[model samples]
Target: MSGATGTGTTMREAFVATAGHLLDEDPRVAVVLAAISADVFADAARRHPDRVIDVGIREQLLVGVAGGMALTGMRPIAHTYAPFLVERPFEQVKLDLGHQGVGAVLVSVGASYDWAAGGRTHHAPGDVALLDTLPGWTVHVPGHPDEVVDLLRRAARTDDRVYLRLTNDGNARAHPVGAGFQVLRTGRRAVVVAVGPVLDRVLAATARLDVTVLYASTVRPFDAVGLRAAVLAADRADVVLVEPYLAGTSTHAVAEALADVPHRVRALGVRRDVELRGYGEPADHDAAHGLDVAGIAARIHAFTRA
Candidate 1:
């Protein structure tokens, strides 16, 4: 597959633009911005003032209001940074949306350390883990701007509770959408699963290794079936899961999926312990967390040999 690098559009721009289109096309579509990317939707807000609203930095009200709109039969799309969207308004997400059984499309940017210079307050390594606590949430971690557009459209069309995670990092190419993992390359010694924006780095990491690589954009409904099939195809019970968030986020699901088979698993992702007080760019944070290409390659090489 060809990797599309240096694309003019970014995931954030794609999401905001597509969301605006949804707002114009569908009357039921309502957007609640937390002043995070309010400017991105300024035109939409002006055109449909009642449908698109900026709650001005209040994360709690941002979610609560969306839930309220959903209750009134409007499909709400709430946008903000990951920390503000999921962490700050967690209770509102749990009670207003989850407990109340109302569905809203929650879109968040600045995944993990995407805004490394913004410090821990802006970092949200636990966003997905927090959402996992609630049941029936369709979580999507798109790796490209095109994928973001597609997933946002999909989420907007349904009333199901959805959380679309957006990040500054991305892969070279966009793959087809499905619940199962898409096999990008084949090998025999082991299988490596790359989640969302980690695909390009994972590919570079395992380039020389004799291992199968699978890419996944949607991880919440972990593709156990596809995972097992890929593992079996590689004829290697050894599996390595590379995620962008906290390590071992999908370890449980992988274990359950391969329960019947004899296998060894390794999980790689951002570290939960220790605070890296220094940050320059996303690459800087990735290197510190051993998520850079060299770091990932070193770990995967050692794991495959083991």
Candidate 2:
């Protein structure tokens, strides 16, 4: 219900506002969460402690309880880290959430390796790529603040299973979450589909170059028309699909789907040969793997102009 922004509504403030809004609507919307999404979850509980049921650091039990709560007609928003949400209770996520087709709102903090300093065990970089292949799961990576707010509210109302990837990538701004893919930058230079927060990197990339940036919010339910238009628009330009996961499924799947598109498709992501290490920042880590703005810009320039 909180739609309009007043004067100084930052994304973080809007985030808590949405949570409070949901809690106000129903006091039974229990938040089952762990340590990762502690920030927003805690704030939500602080504002409406009666509605949130904290599960400490127990991600498995947290989700299991949430799934159980879902069975009883309560909306459960499970907040946890990406690695654990999809990794630990993966079976619960599949059976309790997926097979049952229950609606589970997963608010993941630093869902991707966007956590940077967390290292491998903590780095959930490949989670989205993995979720991309999973059936009955809606994977959403909101790049900007507005997209986050809109999608978070929508997800709250949705009665399906979804795992949200939230992060603090330096350029993640507040933008509306459009269903179809959008052309952040329209150019013939080369189509670099900015995956999620990577779109911000895409914008930063354009500061010194002439590259096209496509803001792709929904990774799953891959926007066929939007993606087709975004990709086909390239019209034989060397195009690359960049992500923060390994060079397998996420990239290959996209490449296969858009193979018919005239553009020469390429993928830029974690090499996977080595465990992804970071310099404690999303941009730096992505830059290290040639997945950041400049790196993607370089690839587009090399592939298109080469």
Best by lDDT: 1
The segments of candidate 2 whose C-alpha lies over 4 angstroms from its true place after superposition are 1-14, 35-50, 170-172, 206-211, 245-249, 259-263, 277-283
Q: 182-267 in candidate 1: lDDT tens per residue?
A: 99999999999999998988999888889999999999799999998888888679999899998888888889998999999888
**Candidate 2: tens digits of C-alpha lDDT, residues 206-237:** 66656567767777766666666655565455
Off by over 4 Å in 1: 1-7
lDDT for 296 (candidate 2)? 71
Q: Which residue pairs clash in candidate 1?
A: 4-172
Top TM-score hit: 1
Question: TM-scores of the models, in the given order?
Answer: 0.96, 0.84
Error of 2 at 290 (Å): 1.2
* Candidate 1, position 39, lDDT: 80
